[model samples]
Structures are given as C-alpha cells and as structure tokens.
Target chain A: GIQVEQSPPDLILQEGANSTLRCNFSDSVNNLQWFHQNPWGQLINLFYIPSGTKQNGRLSATTVATERYSLLYISSSQTTDSGVYFCAVNGFSGGYNKLIFGAGTRLAVHP
Target chain B: EPEVTQTPSHQVTQMGQEVILRCVPISNHLYFYWYRQILGQKVEFLVSFYNNEISEKSEIFDDQFSVERPDGSNFTLKIRSTKLEDSAMYFCASRTRRTSNEKLFFGSGTQLSVL
Candidate 1:
C-alpha cells in the first residue's frame, strides 16, 4: 500500500495572500487528484494531475511523479477558501483504482 | 458536467440496526466506489464495484458490509449491523472509464450517525 502524507497540517492566511500545500507519496501513482472539502462536507474536485502541472482559477497544482510529490497552490486566497484540502492518489492495485487520501491540510483565511 | 448524487444526506441509526446508503452515479460511468471519512480523519476507501461485482475492497469493508448495483442507475451500500464506529461521512464516487487519466467524480456524501 502507498502512503500519502500532506505537510503543514494546519495553515492560516490573511485574505489576498498566497499559500502552498505539499503532498508526498511513498510509491509511484497512476492517478492523483486534489480536492477541497468545504464546511458543508462537500468534496469539490480541484485538479486531476497524475503528473505535470495544471491550473484552475485561483488554484493550481503540480505533480512531480518521479519525485513522488505534489504541490497545491492557492493564490490571492479568499475567506471562502477556508476548509480542508486533500490530495489523493491511485496506485492501481489488483488491476483496479482505489484512491488513497492524505490526512489533508486545514486552511483558514481571515479577512 | 454530470456528477454523482447521494440520497438521504443524513442518516441516524441505532447500533445493530441495518442501514442502507444509496447513490446515483453519472449515467455512463463504469467504475463505482464507496469511501468513508471519520471525523477528523482522511477519506478511506471501502470498496470498488464494476460489472455488477466488487473488484476490490479494503480491510474496513468486512462481512458486515455489502454493495449492490441493484439497477442500471443506482448503487447502494448496506451495513447489516451498524456499530458506533460506523458513524462517518460516506462518499460515493464514479469514473467514466478504467483508464488512469479518467477523472473520478464524487457525490456530496451522506453523514451517518450510529448511536
């Protein structure tokens, strides 16, 4: 089983600031995804980057497959960005995909 | 964009009681999965279903749990006898294909409280 660890378990930022969260996996992965869990418990998909880099609005992510690590960047953060950000990866064991998630980085943006 | 939909946004059940959580995945998706997140914990995979059978399941998915497609559109997870530890946010997810590039979509999740 692959292990996924996220850094800066807790983060606090002022609105309009920028932040970066990191995720390190123990093994090579075939798929990786980033999600933002809102206060209402909705897991909103942010990016599906198994490798390389991708950006979506104020959020962007980059995964270095060879290094087995990924980074999530939140630019010009807003108060609404307060929540838990998770990074999940699929190692494709037994010929199927099962996403293993990191504990997540809890972010709080204050006005 | 199509998404996975789960019913009974919240459920409360007494220990030892039977509980069923239902989901309607994106119409054309072929792979379906159930994952649970205990409060303050990372989301954990429970099971994966394809072709009307379970393809893989984690240790957390034991004899007490079962999954059924039941029909073309609905996927259900049944806990034969719920326990206090069973309380958590259960999420249903689906993907259009088996390819690693296919993105997986998740439902809002059902909050289950076992007393």
Candidate 2:
C-alpha cells in the first residue's frame, strides 16, 4: 500500500488569512484528490488533480506526480473553512481502483 | 447538484449482530466506493464496486465485510458480525468515470456504534 503523509497535523488561523497544506506520497499516483471534511463529517471534494494545477474559488491545489507530492492553498479563509483537509491518492498499482488518504490537516479559522 | 445519500445517519448494534449500511449514490455515476473513518482517524477505503461487482478492496475489507449493488440505485455494505472495532463513520462515494481526474462525490457518512 502507498503511504500518504500530510504536514502540519493541526493549524489555526485568523479569518482573512492565507494558508498552505501539503501532502507527500510514497509512490507514483495517477489519481489524487483533495477533500474537506466539515464538522458534520461531510467529505466534500475540493480538487481532482493528478498533475498540474487547479483552482476553485478560494481553494487551489497542485500535484507533482513525478515528485510524489501535492499542495493545497486557501486564501482569505472564513469560519466555514474550519475543518479537516484531506489528501487522497490512488497509486499506479491500483489504477484508480481505491484511494489512500492522508491523516489530514485540521484547520481552525477564527474571526 | 446531485449528491450521494446514505440512510440512518447513526446506527447502534451489539458486537455479535449483523449490520447493514445503505447508500444511494449519484444516479448518473458508475463507480461506487465505501470508506470508513475511526474516531480521529483518517478515512480509509474499504471497497470499490463497478458493474455490480467489487473492483478492488482493501485488507480491512475482510471476511466480515461485504458490499453489494442490490438494485440499480441502492448500494450497501454489510458487516456479518460486528465488533467493537467496527464502530466508525462509513461513507459512500460515487464517480462518473474511472479516470484519474474524475472527482468523487461523497455522502455525509453513517456513524456506526458497536457495543
């Protein structure tokens, strides 16, 4: 099984600030996704980037498959953004079969 | 915006009882998956189903666990004999394709408590 590691196990930021979260994998992956788990335990897809860069609203992500790493960026964070952010990936061995998730970075945005 | 819907937001069962978790994935999606998260732990993939059969499953999806697409719209995960360790939040997800860039839509998750 491929190993996924996320940095800054916990984070705290004031509203309107910016933050960056990172994920590192142990193998080459063809499928990589970013998810935000809210307090209600709802996992919402944030990005589906295997390579290159993508952005949506105040959230953005970049995956460097060759380097086995990905980055997620949040700008002008709001209270609603407080939750756990997860990075998941499917190793080449699985061929998009199943996703292995990182331990997630818990973020707390305060006003 | 269609979403994956799951039944019984929370379930409580005895350690030796059988429990079934139900889900209704996005109608148009073809790939479905089951993932679980223990308290304060990362979400782990249990199984992936495609074309009415399991495409892939993790080690955690052992003898006690099984998945089925009973009908065209409903998918389920059954634990033959629950254990205290089986208590966790189970999530159902669906995707329109098998490609790497395809995004998965996940349900809110069903919290199972085994006593």
User: Which digits, one per residue and each the tens of the lDDT, describe model 1 over residues A1-111?
Assistant: 899999999999999999999999999888999999999899999999999999989999999999999999999999999999999998855467778899999999999
The best candidate by TM-score is: 1
TM-score attained by model 2: 0.92
For lDDT, the strongest prediction is 1
For residues A22-85, what per-residue lDDT tens digits would candidate 2 score against the true structure? 9999999888999999998888888889899999999999998989999999999999999999
**Interface RMSD, Å, model 2:** 1.9
Tell me each candidate's TM-score.
Answer: 0.97, 0.92
Interface RMSD of each: 1.4, 1.9
- Where does candidate 2 clash, by residue pair? none
